[model samples]
Target: MRKLYVWDPLVRAFHWALVAGLILNMFVTNPGKTAHRWLGYGVLTLIALRLVWGLIGPKFARFRSFPPDPAAALDHAREIVTGRVHPHEGHSPLGALMVYNLLASCLIIGLTGWMLTTLTWFGVEWVEDLHKAFVTWVQLCAVLHIAAVIFESRRLRVNLPKSMVTGYKTLP
Candidate 1:
């Protein structure tokens, strides 16, 4: 196995912070409450920081390194079906799609949550429904992301979750 520095410190911090924020908002804080609203704002701030970091951060953290590409993701899926062992130093193609999806979902959820706090959109049923829907969507995506990470780690002989925590990947 070869150890490589992959995830940077900012990337790891952003990942874990987002995880905490999502968990707090989704399960601990009641929707429409002050705590929920504040957590949503915190998530929005994290997303904004991640967007800027994706522009100017390290090579693996950059948007150019893992641009969302459906075709590439599909190819990756094919590779998985065929049991190919191609290890990406950064986010894999499917992983990139998930990152994009989660970022967009969190942004929409934050916007809708903020809308609910404004006088104009307060008590608006559709806005509330949209926020709830996105919360569910994000939760589902989180499950999928975790499962994929575990599966890929075993399949590729790389400790993917460990890499996110330690900023190093032990790749086979």
Candidate 2:
């Protein structure tokens, strides 16, 4: 086994920050409250920062490190079903797809949320409904993300959650 440094500090910070902001907005803060709006802005800012980092960050932190490839994801799923282990040092193909999914979903949520505060879109039912839909999508994705992480961790014998927390993955 070898310990590889994968996630960067900024990446880890962004992940936790986004998690906190999402939890705050989804549960603790009311939609119309100032705190909720600011939290949403903070989450959006973190995502924007993450997008920039995905272009120029460290090796494993860059999006290029884990391109979204359907073929690769299929192979990964096949391996899982066939009881073959292929441990990835960075984000796996399926995980990369999830990352992109969450990023896009969050972006939509944030944009529609901001639109709600605009004069033209204020009190617009469609915009509000769209925002809520994205929020629900993200919430579902987050749960799936967590479950997949745990499942992959055991399957691959790598602590994925710990890698995100400690910036290192012990690969077998």
lDDT of each: 0.94, 0.93
In order of listing, the candidates' clash counts read: 0, 0
RMSD of each: 0.8, 0.6
Q: What is the TM-score of each candidate against the true structure?
A: 0.97, 0.98
**Residue-level lDDT tens digits of model 2 in 1-172:** 9999999899999999989999999999999789988888998899999999999999988988998899999998999999999898899999999999999999999999999988999999999999999999999999999999999999998999999999999998
lDDT by residue (tens digit), candidate 1, 114-144: 9999999999999989999998999999999
> Model 1, residue 41: displacement in angstroms?
0.8
Model 1 pairs in collision: none
lDDT, residue 172, candidate 2: 84
Lowest lDDT sum, 10 consecutive residues, model 1, at 25-34
